[model samples]
Target: MNALILVADDEADMEPLFRQQFRRDIKAGRFDLVFTTSARQALRIIGDAGQHDILLLLSDINMPEMSGLDLLARAKAARPNLPIIMVTAYGDADTRRRALAGGADGLLPKPIDFPALRVEINRCLAQWGAGP
Candidate 1:
């Protein structure tokens, strides 16, 4: 089964990095990626991607248009059971607290641990009853 993942981050470098990191999964059609730069775009994708087999929503806490924490709340309101994860360059306690409070399933600090992210994605998929 294909697992679609929606990612929201302002960094222009993330697309290449993610495409490189999950090259196999993406090429084999096991994972499909949709990249966006802002929270607004991410929310629109969330609303539209619901019909697909969306596995997770990954967003950066710090963004230009809107914060990922706010996106988390809006996404949750759109899809209560959606498993959303927050990533940020800042690993501060307050940011984490806000993310959790806003209904994020996981909080990851940047530079992202790719290995750990893979594990977390699978774990999130399993929790949502979707095999990784």
Candidate 2:
């Protein structure tokens, strides 16, 4: 099945970068990525899209409106089973601890290593007994 990953960040450049990085997987129908620039938008999408289709959620800890940590709380409240990973450039022990406490499935620091992201995605899918 195709995994639909929703990534919420304020970075406008991320879409093209992610597309380029995951082109092979996207073409193979192994994964599909949806991007939202704000946590609020992401939350709305998550509410509307349902957790079954959205295999994973990747969100930046910093954003204009709602923070990723807040999104984590909202998403987890809506769907506790959903896996949501928090990403940020300001990743530190305190931030990591807060994210974990807020129910984030994983915490990834930026500049995101695409290869590591791939591994983490696969591991997350395996954990949920899904694929790609």
Best by lDDT: 2
Candidate 2 differs from the real structure by a C-alpha RMSD in angstroms, to one decimal, of 1.8
Give me the overall lDDT of model 1. 0.86
Candidate 1 — which pairs collide?
none
lDDT of 2 by residue, 1-132 (tens): 466889999999999999999898889877789999999999888898544378789999999879999999999998788898899998899999999999998888998888988988788767666764
lDDT for position 80 in model 2: 88
List, residue by residue over 1-132, the lDDT tens digit for candidate 1.
567788999987999999999998788776788899999988887788546667889999889978888899999998898888899999889988889988998899998999989998778768766667
* CA error at residue 41 for candidate 2, angstroms: 0.9
TM-score of each prediction: 0.91, 0.91
Rate residue 79 of model 1 by lDDT.
Answer: 85
Question: Distance (Å) between predicted and true CA of 88, model 1?
Answer: 0.4
Q: After superposition, how far is residue 26 of candidate 1 from its true place, in Å?
A: 0.9
